[model samples]
Target: MMRQKHNFVAGGIAAAALVALMGLAGCSTTAGVETTGKTSWDEQGARILEKNVVFNSSSLKGDLQIVDLRGVQAGDIMRAQATLRSRDKDTLQFQYRFDWYDAGGLEINSGAGSWKPLLLTGRETKTVQGVAPDPRAKEFKLKIREME
Candidate 1:
């Protein structure tokens, strides 16, 4: 009976450990900042472009700011750039990625983007750029997060 009880305890510990690992894995992708840019025509019959920035992590929002977001077309491909300002007085590292989308708001090359590293010094201002994988991209979203 003692041997059976010991085995049960060991199995329970292993099962608990597996559950804890899965929980942490689910939280591996911690959202930090997301910014979207789109192009459209306004009611004045003029062309208009917009940039929307959203911060999902309070720590990141307190440390950084998205100063400028610009998107342009180079012949047929969409190019995007974003200027970031570090508010903290210390250097920090980040990972940024660009997600391309079609005119109809569907993602292009979904789940194919790789995160590029960015380094910023104290109160530094820097710009990061991204190019679409192809010509079908008409919109873009920039995502910034703390480097793991």
Candidate 2:
């Protein structure tokens, strides 16, 4: 009779442990799915672009408009526009760099640093456009650096 009771207690404990393990596994899977859904480049690239570009006034700050983005088999073509303005009567000089990345989250090689210069008048707004060099570019990043 004692052996029978011991066996019953052991079986109950094992069943409870199995249930707890299954619950933990489910929670782990949910966390993994949530983490993987976010794009790797979204936060880092966006912050870099915004930090370097300065807006004199809330009204004059240029808008970063994405006109078109087409995903090709090997690469992608992204069309973007930006408007710049200065609240004070001072001319501003700026430069931009387009960084391309492959599917494996690595930056592809390009000519030099691939930087382009831009100029703006006081309280003047402007737009800019660019094209990708090749097809292996799955993603792109724009960095605007203030000069002078």
Candidate 3:
């Protein structure tokens, strides 16, 4: 009887773990979200050249919000700032990376950018900033994803 009960409990634990793993697998998407900010100049002055927001994960789209994205020149290198807000009532762990592009829409380092950790509390608003890898970078794309 004791051996049977032990086996039953172990089986239950394994089953529960498997279910959790399956649920997470369904939500697993590395794509996360992406937003771009660029600078443009003409006769007037510097202006927001382009802005694009893309969501690759539906779950992340519902939990994370991008309030504002802006880009400016810090000396020769371009800097980017993004305002992010958490919609859920729980703290979240995420990773963010910045990709730099030149004036002709070419990526600076391609896949060289490293993912940085970001922690956002419930209903908290935070601004994250990134600096271009080189002076030729005129546009920046910010990507956010759940901690893997």
| lDDT by candidate, in order shown | 0.92, 0.48, 0.91
How do the residues 10-47 of candidate 3 rate in per-residue lDDT, one tens digit apiece? 99999999999999988866669999988888777846
Compared with the true structure, what per-residue lDDT tens digits does model 2 show for residues 1-148?
Answer: 9999999999999999999999886664211000001123465464112222333323223322222222223234433333444444567666666666656757768554555777766756666554556655555555555542
TM-score of each: 0.78, 0.44, 0.82
Worst 10 residues of 3 by lDDT: 41-50
Residue pairs of candidate 2 with colliding backbone atoms: 62-83, 75-135
> Could you tell me which residue pairs clash in candidate 1?
none
Q: Could you tell me the lDDT of residue 82 within candidate 2?
A: 39
Give RMSD (Å) of candidate 2 vs. truth: 19.7
Top candidate (TM-score): 3
List where candidate 3 sits over 4 angstroms from the true fold: 1-29, 42-45
lDDT of 2: 0.48
Question: Candidate 1's residue-wise lDDT over 1-148, tens digit each?
Answer: 9999999999999999999999898777666899998876789987567889999999899999999999887999889999999999999999999999998999998999999999999999999999999999888999999886
What is candidate 3's CA lDDT for residue 69?
90
